[model samples]
Target: MSKKKKPSVLIYTDGACSGNPGPGGWAALLSWNGKEKEISGGEPDTTNNRMEMRAIIEALKALTRPCRVEIRSDSALIINAFKQNWVGSWIKRGWKKSNKKPVENQDLWKEMLKAMKPHDVTWTKVKGHADDERNNHVDGLAVEASKQYQ
Candidate 1:
């Protein structure tokens, strides 16, 4: 007998802020087997990058078991960080960047890393505020969340 395989999940995430370091929000949309779920939250005072990482972290935490996941985002900082091994390098160098500066969001980055440890995850870059319907939806969710904190 063979075990059944779980369907892969598709997730879209986005983050928004009233100012670079002002009230912010994060949103994630998870879909599997034609079922979709959306989650979002806001921070009274947070940076856009923190919200972005928070969105991904929260989405991965929603998974019940180890499985393949494809996450789409409009933040190149995230997609490029993983694709270019920026996170690995930072961990290897005391959470400092190439210039020896402390990583801006070490705490959030660490949380995201731990949340992603059990799954095979892929990151795809999507154009922000553009034609992609899913992206647009998630972006709208994030914007709404941001408004909640205002």
Candidate 2:
């Protein structure tokens, strides 16, 4: 038997925080089959990195079925974790970094991994606040969402 090919999806995400550990927001733009959907949410108290991870998690969760997903984000923390296999290392080390410190945002990281199980996911690092129209759009959405909590 052969497996059915999953639908392809492109997601661009961004996160913003009014103050570190203060109000924060995350946004994602999902594109599939010539259609696009934007989703965003905010937290009264959260870190920027948490919001970044949240954006990814929420986007993946929104998919009704498994897909071939490409996620673009400006966050090095999120990008490097997968590209550099930092998440794998941390998991092997019992969720601790090289310096023996507990990984920050472990909760979200775990949630993201679980949400990713149903799909084939790829990551792309996009230049933030630059000329990338999609990236800028998500950034603006995230910033505006953050302001709501202010």
Candidate 3:
């Protein structure tokens, strides 16, 4: 007999910032086995990219077990990093880009890497504020959360 595989979870994440370096927010929607959970939070001062990265980090952290995960995000930096092997390359180069510059979000990337270590995750890129309903919903949640910190 073979063990049944658990259902894969789907997560949609988004981030917003009141200003480039001002109050920011991140939101994530996790769906599994016909159930869904939404989470959002804000920071007093941050950047949109950080919030974007945080959304994925938090969603991965929320998982209670080692399961398959599919992450959809609007940030090119996040999606491309995984899809294009940017993270692996960065790690090989000691967290420095090809230009010999330090990676901008090394801390968050490290956290995300740790969170991802035990799970199987596939990343998908979605256009922000576009036709995707789930992405749009999370975008709204992030914007609202950002206002609380502004």
What does candidate 3's lDDT look like per residue over 69-98, in tens digits?
A: 999999999899999999999999999999
Worst 10 residues of 3 by lDDT: 3-12
- Tell me the spans in candidate 1 whose CA falls farther than 4 Å from its real position: 1-6
Colliding residue pairs in candidate 3: none
Query: What does candidate 3 score on TM?
Result: 0.97
lDDT of 1 by residue, 1-150 (tens): 999675699999999999999999999999998999999998999989999999999999999998799999999999999999999999999999999999999899999999999899999999999999999999899999999998
Over 1-150, each residue of candidate 2 has an lDDT whose tens digit, in order, gives 999899999999999999999999999999999999999999999989999999999999999999999999999999999999999999999999999999998999999999999999999999999999999999999999999998
True-structure lDDT of candidate 2: 0.97
TM for every model, in the order presented, reads 0.96, 0.98, 0.97
Q: Residue 48 in candidate 1 has what lDDT?
A: 92
Model 2, residue pairs in steric clash: none
Ranking by lDDT: 2, 3, 1
What is the Cα-based lDDT of residue 72 in candidate 1? 98
Best by lDDT: 2
